[model samples]
Target: MSGTQPTVTLSGGGADDARTVVRALEGTFGAPDERPGDGNATVHTATFAGETDGSAADGGGEGAGRLSAPVTVTVQGSPEAVRRASETLARVFTARDDGAASGDQEQERELHLMP
Candidate 1:
């Protein structure tokens, strides 16, 4: 909603893993609207400000590192946004395309990122 970047929701991983994943996306989507917090909760969410021009930002890629456990991430936004997020995550993590559901103008995809 901020621009064109998808709002990503992540569950089933530790706090470190969540931040790492967010950091990876930051490299492509710029900083998130609000940074991911430290937590043991089942889910963590990050919303990108979507102000950047999709140029490579900073924080991850090539050294993003893998998660200690599997992480299930959901990306919701326009079709283009969903596709870009999915592609970025797949490149940064060991990801499995669990599935995707589409809405009128929004698309949601679920992926599993493994260590």
Candidate 2:
């Protein structure tokens, strides 16, 4: 079996959301049995890839807008466990339109899984 840990990229509406997701992941997969390095699993660094605001033509508001960033969350654990954790994260973070669609303010975030 492969002995390498998987890498997952989560797109968040902002840095705050990214931080929340990272914390959520640690809580989900960093349990005593999984994360021995709290003495068990290693908490890799979390990175934010910056945010971009679309122009008026593309669908941005007059001035400021909701921020978005690419968040990379890394944890060391069994491959099976990591994959399961990532899938669960995807489901939890899926975007939902509350009422911003009409204003052309919908934000799209995607999660990428890497082996």
Candidate 3:
């Protein structure tokens, strides 16, 4: 926790969306250190310290250290929220041009909650 911790920001969905993502992350990383945003901009943010369960020694291997990096997540809402969320989100999520592009190219793309 010396340098800047990594962060993951998600926007455009809503407050509920932000809560959903926060819940999902909490399930894996335990309680976060900071939960800013809230109703301030319909935006929400959560920060977690880098930690691991030492499962690597138990042969859990590879991705076992997923939480080894500090992370901050934000969901979008208001205009300001959208701007900030988008900037941070871009750092975590990126556009992948897989060549196999298909479907209605005219349709606007937004974040969708998955089951």
True-structure RMSD, every candidate:
2.4, 16.9, 12.8
Predicted structure with the largest TM-score when compared to the true one: 1
C-alpha TM-score for every candidate: 0.87, 0.33, 0.37
Candidate 3: minimum summed lDDT over ten consecutive residues — where?
Answer: 57-66
Candidate 3, residue 58: how far the Cα is off, in Å: 13
* Candidate 2 lDDT tens digits, 1-115: 2322333343323445444555444433331212211222223334222112212212211222222443444433344444444455554444232221111322222343221
lDDT of 2 at 8: 35
Cα displacement (Å) at residue 53, model 1 = 3.8
Query: For residues 1-115, could you state the per-residue lDDT of candidate 1 as single tens digits?
Result: 4436789999887888888888888766778877668756778999876734545743235476778889999999888778778888888888899999998878999999998
Report how far residue 104 has shifted in candidate 1, in Å.
0.7
What are the lDDT scores of the predictions, listed in order? 0.80, 0.35, 0.36
Estimate the TM-score for candidate 2: 0.33
lDDT of 3 by residue, 30-72 (tens): 3457653446454455654432353321221222122222233
